[model samples]
Target: MQIVDRLMTPSPDDADARRCPHDGTTLVSRISPLRSAVRRCPACLRSWSDVTTSATADPPARFHSFRLDVRPEPAAPSAAPPAPELSVVLPALNEAAALPLLISDIETALAGESYELVLVDDGSDDATWAVIRAVLAERPQWQAVRLSRRFGHQAALLAGLAAARGRAIISMDADGQHPTEQLPEMVRRWREGARVVQAVRASDARGGMLKALTSRGFYRAFSRLCEAPMRSGAADFRLLDRTVVETVLQASRTTPFLRGLIPWLGYETHHLTYEPRSRIAGRTKYSLRRMARLATDGMVSFSVAPLRLATLVGAAVGALALADLIYIVAVALWDGRAVPGWASTVGLVALLGAVQLFSIGLLGEYVGRTYLALLNRPPYVVAERIGDSSGPPPAGERRA
Candidate 1:
């Protein structure tokens, strides 16, 4: 057999060779885990091949080859990180300007706590997705979902909630109007066993007088009409324990009015009242038309009062018509007088026609909502995603 010997570049007697580079332990020649040809550091477990004996029959020739050091044992794969304790779900709509500061504020607010931020881009025309990507690169713990199109605020919030994977999830707007500073207090309440923690805004200065009046009015009307009790100032800014989050997702297939749904769920709830802050940048996505639609949805979803009121109106109109007809007929029969007021007859016909049309329209609203629910379409489609290492599976992805 051919005898091949190898030498290390530096003599082991030298300072560099004498001490282990990793832990300062003395280097020693020992039987390698592989075979007898390698030397290793006992402390660091790094091995270097000092000699190799070939199996070839070459008259016992001595061959000198360069020292071969086996690569350090492949590091044991790191275990996956634990799940986050809390998740902040922000449904963004063209709030690119506010994202940078909003993300910073959230990180600062949630410092020393294990939390994830879930950003849902509701098909923003602005650089909202781009900004989200940059933030994700810097903060790998956060995740984002981009919708195929603008699916409204409720749909976006649903998508974020579906994507969030923390023990407790907080849903809020991306405009920075919802204060991140209150997050800890929300969490504190959650820790105290509150399944639903609502952030109640006393007034929205940015929304102006008309919005405030309408908002207040809607809640007052909603409370009296619907069995589900909702506080006037309660909004989308709220915290849900994992149980509540899952319950909401399973319960709502269509776009849900969360302000109404949360109370309807009847979980142990706590409320925190705070003043609304101005947007960090950009205008509010909620327009007058959108607010009206939201109110309509809330009223329609939770209450059949409109339909009942329609029925009551029809009955009252019928009773009045019957009484009038009896008066006219009795007078005609008793006095043998012909009723000849064409204008009065025409006005009565018009009044009846208006009532009939109003009842039909109210009935149509309920029918329309039922038809939509029957269609069973996903509320929002996720076109793309980033940072899925921890968040839930893509909620209705349409991969490009």
Candidate 2:
């Protein structure tokens, strides 16, 4: 029997420096080998010989053959079908008036391909659900899910995406601010192998100066904090490939900022600029308080900037306290002045009050989140599901 030694190459591309099984020494070739194939290590000299033809021969002579074929067969092609046409998910709260126009625009956007429109009603006190049902009745292409109570805008959007059947999904505002005309461009980007296609609203002709300025500032601050490739003027109106959608969905947390989450999930993304149109109907759902809360969520979810800021503040306070102690010591030793009782009392009170407030605020932020989690409160609840209840209920509907 012939003995053969095998060596493992460092890389598929590298042919030299193969490990020798006999002496455990690396074998280096003067010239590059034809292919980096697994061969017998020279050190151990361990080998296997063919004895089929020499079965009757006793103590057959050993022959070394290094020309044996070790190539592997090529893999078979994938049998999976092409991705679905498009899935449009709209999150609406008290947007009954704008639903018709939004639906119409979506239908126009998906003219060439088979598409499904999912409307998530975020527990609107108005006739939003009624309007959604009416639209579905008139347009069979549309489907909807109603939350038991208001689950906030982001949660509703998540619900819609979870229920989407299309291989590519588009998320837009129910306020009709997002331009449906941009759909063709977004779809083109998707076809060109972009996993995430963002609709960046470069101009908001309908918004006032104050709103525009605030938005620009927020985006700027957010971009700086996030590591993802975030650009200014990007909005939630965007399209995602099936893989990206699945990836984002898998990262399901109670506080979901999809716009930020898209970048966190590494994928090829494309951005298209468009002018945000005016709302077709209904007042804006996002009040100042809600916007602040959303901003806080986005900041905390994507970055530790706040925590760092808190650290800086604590350090600054410590330094100030040290300075105050030094000042009091100087007055006692050198100034030969009596320590003013009111001044010390006032300074201590203010300093302690500021510290207490800051600490409470920081603790409240973390405590509030923990409370929500402990309660096991769902992000949203589905009161009724239209079209295919056999399938999974809308996002945030499943009880943990």
Candidate 3:
């Protein structure tokens, strides 16, 4: 669909030639200033812009009072332009049932602008690919990337974001839990010049007591531990402008904590509150084990607090050991009796061993991440391409 039909209003400079962010192509103006202006990108899709500023320049006073319209000239017609609206990237794993509704909600939210939907299916052994194909068939603006295997949700999201062509990109869950209705507010904030719009979960009651509590606790601790500015209840359902997306893409790390990565990139940001909804269909992709692993990953990926704590612990243990040694020597020299309990020695030995092991494990986690980085493995490999067949299909597109 053409983008102008979706605009609630138009901008005053709507008739002026605008450059596409994805490609340096100039766009042709389709409508007048009163209505929405359709600027078809030379490389991608048509986009609509609101008419806030006037296309006609103010008349010069004094001698010019006699009046001339002094209206700006319209842009020349050009090749198909790149899409100008936001790119919505939804990472899916066995989420066939929820995909349709999620897409519908996003379409409704982005009613007035042109957008591209990139659905990255992360190795689902179900009808997820079928659903994606169906959506793309119905909507030419959509794209699908299927991975060869389950590269995990974060990797899938990264793939989709990498392929996004919008000036702004948004990432959210495919389970319909992330409310698409909040998108307009995000876009409004973007229009107000915020580069990043983070969605902070107002409440996660649908996630159940255990999961919700764990999530809250993790975020609370993480905020205190990480140097990066991460909100306590913020999540992956976020909108990023072109600058933020480009910066993030340049961060070439195989193991990525995207929620933390954006803040580290340092951009003007805004926050929106949305109650996270329960999954409409399919089981929860993030199991407890997966959550724990992700938490650990976030901790190590974003903070050095663990390492510092380890050093402090070691120092404290050494001081205690020295004090104990001094106490033993004083007892032998003055009291003439060694205050020794076999049980106490055994407990102390076990405690020290456990502490040593725990410290080693924490250090090893960081080392393991470093090792993975050194290996330089591709985050995900695409197995097939379904609709366009231009390159290898996404990984999950492969037939079993």
Give candidate 3 regions above 4 Å deviation.
1-81, 318-341, 386-400
| Candidate achieving higher lDDT, 1 or 2 | 1
Candidate lDDT values, in order: 0.80, 0.73, 0.76
**TM-score, every prediction:** 0.74, 0.71, 0.72
The candidate that wins on lDDT is 1
Clashes of each: 0, 10, 32
Candidate ordering by TM-score (highest first):
1, 3, 2
The Cα RMSD of model 2 versus the native structure comes to 17.5
Error of 2 at 179 (Å): 0.9
Per-residue lDDT over 32-52 for candidate 3, one digit per residue giving the tens place of the 0 to 100 score: 434445444333665735333
Q: List all candidate RMSDs to the true structure.
A: 10.1, 17.5, 17.7
Clashes of 2: 10
Clashing pairs in 1: none
